[model samples]
Target: MNLSMPIDAVTMLLMTQAIALVAALVLAAEWRLAKVRSLAWWSAGFATIVVGSGMSVLRTADSFLLYVWLANGLLVVAHLLFAKGAAAFAGRRLPGIWLGVLLVWVALLGTDPASDRTALFGLVNSALVAILSLKAASLLLSLRRTSEVRDAVRLGHIFLGHGIFYLAKSGLIFMPGLFVSLVGFKGLLIKASLYEGILVEVSLALLMLAAVRHRRERQITALAERDSLTGAYNRRAFEAKAAAGMALARRAGQPVALLLCDVDHFKAVNDGFGHATGDRLLSALAGILTDCVPADALVARLGGDEFAVLLFGLPPENLPALGRRICHRFAQSGAGVAGASLQVSTSIGAAASITGTEELPHLFDRADRALYDAKRKGRDRMSVESGVDLSVATPPLRLAKVARRA
Candidate 1:
């Protein structure tokens, strides 16, 4: 049997296979680097595309069912896996019902005894691709809301464009006179579709790599800014964030407050228990401070048992109350470590900016002095400094509590 093929059709077949090879190589690299599961799924999807398109290229006059049923089915599965990969990248689950839909389509194709299966195959394959691509686009777009990845929006747009292309291709099948024939290898429309598919496949693979790179960059930055033990911001990150917050607050004429807290008798806890227990206690206290503060507050572990909180737009008058709350919450919730009923508490010194221009070190020093006063009075107490400058005698706001062993 003689088989006639368009030049563009052959080109499309070669390009699809090349795309599969590139995707597989990318998957291997990603697995070696981070073992990212999404890349694996996408690579599998591209391989399926290659197999399906290869089958299409090999189809002869006697092999109509091969192109109509098996090849088209593979393409549907490929798009479904692409959607699954996008869902995985976005940290979500794709519905199992989609897989069932593909299975049902394949079963229906087998049962149908239609003389011309061209339109049916086109409709089913294009519809599935459209749905899956749109779903992938939606998942990627949703990730943009919470992720700091810079390429999230770009990837989402790419997926969205692919979805729109498939949707238009599907709609063209239903419209009369849009194509010269229903055969995928013939007509100017088929050539256009082939070119568009090549572009989408290549661009999608590249953009997916870009998105992964962006996520890795964000992870690296987060690790640098975060403390290894407590998962809170490190002292350097805290100072940088606090400085920016203070500058913004000054510009907006909003008050900024700093709370310096020291875990009283932390050394005793280390001495009594092991250093591991002391670390657990610090982690527990970090959680408590995080929970007690407002959402906008910047909390950090400022080395050893000391922690810092930077509150923006909060009134200076509220500083004392915030300090008391931190101390009370830490004493109540952070008292025990790892089921051990060891008593623990925090001493907090709070200072608020009279003017936003006050240096972070100066404000921290004032809060440190107040923290010193709290330690002097008792372990489980709070002290508030009224002025940024030490020249003004700010009476310490004291919480009465019995002194504990250090």
Candidate 2:
């Protein structure tokens, strides 16, 4: 393909348009994923595609090398941003000054390349490429740690492949300059054209690959955070959100309540009936829990019979009623415990956050103690522990924020 293709005005226009379209799509996706640090890296690449292509369309060899240099400058920024995005996605952060250096490189690239600026630009570009290669290598190394190897491998493929492509392009662009100084312009034009052709095709292919990888990564993440059985937030996800809710409540000086419950003697039913029956019972329980909870509340099965509820922004006055309603609904559930005439009952322990003094963990601890106390006092009853109005002595709210760092 490179052998036959001719470089002309039409080729340049088409290339510009193609780059812009792809970049725009990537940018849109990144905007959607602004909250996700990993996606941010892809977004940076998309931005670079746009800027670099624009520069190529506007500048020629005869034109001021400034524009061409600027394009190279944007390429560096794009890679740096992508590296940062990758690190962010990998749950790490790189030094900020690297990005600062990239910005400075862009400024330098905008200057006339005929001046002393060329040497500086060359040094910066080399450094940028080296850093990008290292970053890509790091991402590949981290791939094994990811739970979903397929998706991580896909991302690694992108980083590894693109890292090589960019490195090749850097070599191709710089090699001709070196050769021209040594062997003269005799072979430079032909050699440069060959390299450019390879660069363009490989880059386009890699961009498409990256787009696919990005979508797959999102899906993989969604699957990881989601419960496979119940299609709700899994334990890890629930804990994360619960902690965030606690932080928000503390910041806003509002109350947060948690309700922990379990299917009354669920094991005996599973033992008496088959596993399928137990699954159905659990599914039925999930449905009931989903139906009764407020839209703002979070519900999760901690495992087996144990379930959790995080009620954000609810006042203490309303929490007891909520607890009562939950208890009442569970009591009314028709599925009786195995070989029992009485319906299955949930022993619930509810705890609400106290203003100014009570921490998130303490609230959970108190609620848990209250639950233990409830089971001790009698099964199938709702226990409310208000850390504030301890007219009811629920174990000192000895809860730690679910995922909050001490």
Candidate 3:
């Protein structure tokens, strides 16, 4: 078999093969460690592209139907899979209608007039590719906004560029006389397409790998910084975040409030019931803190039934109210738990920075003293400390309505 082919055809063949190889390598990486589902779909898409391009290169003049069905069908399926992969990456499910569209396209290819009109086939293929590419790009761009990984944004831009390129290629086909002239020239249009395709393939492959890496790194970081039980930040993370928040507050001339809360009778709950029940109480309390605090506030578990909250831009007067809200919410939540006999209560100590010059440790110490005072004078109450600035007023410590034990 003579392997010699037109330069443009050879280039397309090589580009498709290269893309397939890259996708395979990415899939292999996914299998070994990452196990990303989207990579597998992308690999399948690249494989189909390789098969389609190969068929286009090898098809003879007599095999018109075979060429139309295999070449065009594979390319369309490849784009569909690419779209599916993008949806998977964005954690979205593609609609069933997309699969139906592909089925209809294959059915049209089998029809009498549709398969015979090569120019019409080209136009439809271009339109399908443009649509799928644009859809994939939109999904990626939307994901970029909420994603912490920077590579996701880069991948979005790449997908957007690829979509725009295909849209331009499709639009050129509708131009008067230009499509015919381009089709008449054997190598020109194909060469341009192959060049752009190769660039897009290389860029997308690299960016996809980077995106996966960034996401994995973020997951690892979260595991390290967060408490495994409650999904709250651990002690170390809490201190680091508190320091950063205090620094920001100082610069903005805003007050930062710290609340140190300890479960009132955690040991009693464990002794009366079991550790599991105590764990449930702590988890419930964490949920209450999350719900009661503002979105900008940082809530963390500082180990062993103690939780911390850092609130920025809140005045000293508001600390008492926030603390009460947390206690009230936790008490309300405790009433609804399965073990009604096990009463859960919290003692919270709040300290607010008036001068914006106080360090996190000193502020924490003040809150800890206040928390001790709350614990000493019965549980289920909040103690507010008016630090350094004597001008700042402190609200009276009041106990909220306690949840009844069965």
Candidate 4:
């Protein structure tokens, strides 16, 4: 298939410049501050220029004419790598064997001349493009299934744009010079490249926008789950975590404990020293709570001057010691009014999973009752409720009935 039509140097340069401009525009649109960045966006931008430049060079009768082929070959490799990056960023893993296959193809490209390997390499590359295109499509579908509309749109565009580009490129390689005589050499090939490059550029731009938007959404969600004053997980996050922990404990047939700790005289602290000092105290308490609990434990600010912890896989016998340790740590931290050495104390109520019927809210209620018992008995003491009163109650109903004899 000979492309006999006259394609002047000016026309070819115009086409290449157009492709470069499109790629640059999209690249700028997708620019972001991500940890690993979006590989698809970067690769698409790189391929646009690399392939366009290669095509441009191949047009000129210069010493670098052969180098242009090598450049395009490298661009193809970059395209594959970009696909892999896209899958990873989207939280999907591609098979390692695919990379091995691509490497073999690259080796074949190096050993085989363009005339000998063009058709075979094009076919192999097309197969690779098909795989990536399918993966992108599947990702988009999964996003839709999960109701990730923005992500779905972004990935769908990527799939559509790249699909078109690859199809056109594949056709161009497989049927080189087929339509060149009718329309011209630069006319057919350049048109195909330009169209494909434009689609790729637009898709990447939209995807980057989606990523930035998604990141912002996640940040907002995190903020929603955080306490405004102490920067700890709010009651909502705590409840959710508690429920999950209880479910896990049930599945594992293990014991789980819930702790409710309230700062003693917290209201007085706020009233006497103002909320500004109160807030600092709360922040300090938050830190102390975090330090006292296991790293994997879920700790949260349940409400005004109160915090909770859902300890999974904890033995019931350890509750008393753990509570004492927390109290000790809080005292050592000196979390109090006006930066002076202040003694801060908490009344802790602990409850353990007993019957399979125990739910998170029930556990919390038991803990809260125990906390009430602790305050009634006296502040600065730990109360454990396992259907028995750990501490004695006098005239004014100071003792809470534990679930069982502890």
Work out the TM-score per prediction.
Answer: 0.87, 0.44, 0.87, 0.53
Candidate 3, residue 39: lDDT: 81
Over 1-406, each residue of candidate 2 has an lDDT whose tens digit, in order, gives 4433443533644564466456556655745754565565655665676666566566655554545576666667666766776676566777766667666665664566455443345445645665685675576458577554354455556566555654554465445343231111123433443345335434533543464467567778889987777666788988888777777778888777777777666666555555665666566666667787778778888787777888777777776656556666655553442323334556678887755235657767878877776676656666776432212222211111122124
RMSD of each: 5.2, 17.2, 5.0, 11.4
Instruction: Determine the C-alpha RMSD for candidate 1 after optimal superposition of all C-alphas.
Output: 5.2
**Candidate 1 Cα lDDT to native:** 0.75
User: Can you write out model 1's per-residue Cα lDDT over 147-224, one digit (the tens) per residue?
Assistant: 447576687888798888878887887566444443447654566767777788888888878887778888999999
Q: What TM-score does candidate 1 reach?
A: 0.87
Off by over 4 Å in 4: 1-27, 30-59, 62-214, 335-337, 387-406
What is residue 394's positional error in candidate 1, in angstroms? Answer: 22
Taking the tens digit of each residue's C-alpha lDDT, what string does model 3 give over 78-133?
87887888888889988978886577567665557533355555566767777888
Question: Which residue pairs in candidate 2 collide?
Answer: 361-399, 361-400, 361-401, 362-397, 362-399, 365-399
Candidate 2's C-alpha runs over 4 A off are 2-6, 9-17, 33-35, 60-65, 103-127, 165-406
Candidate models: Cα lDDT each: 0.75, 0.59, 0.73, 0.62
lDDT of 1 at 21: 74
Q: Write the per-residue lDDT of candidate 4 for residues 1-406, one digit (tens) a residue.
A: 2334444544544555565555545545555334444544444545555554545445432422243344445445555555565565566766776566556555664553434444454555555665566565565556556535476456666765676666666666646553232112344554454445445655554565566568667878889999987878998888787677778778878788888887777766666556786688778878877887787788899788888888877788877777777766665444344544345566788888853338887887899988888887766667877534443221221111122222
Output the lDDT of residue 305, model 3: 95
Worst 10 residues of 4 by lDDT: 393-402
Score candidate 3 by lDDT. 0.73
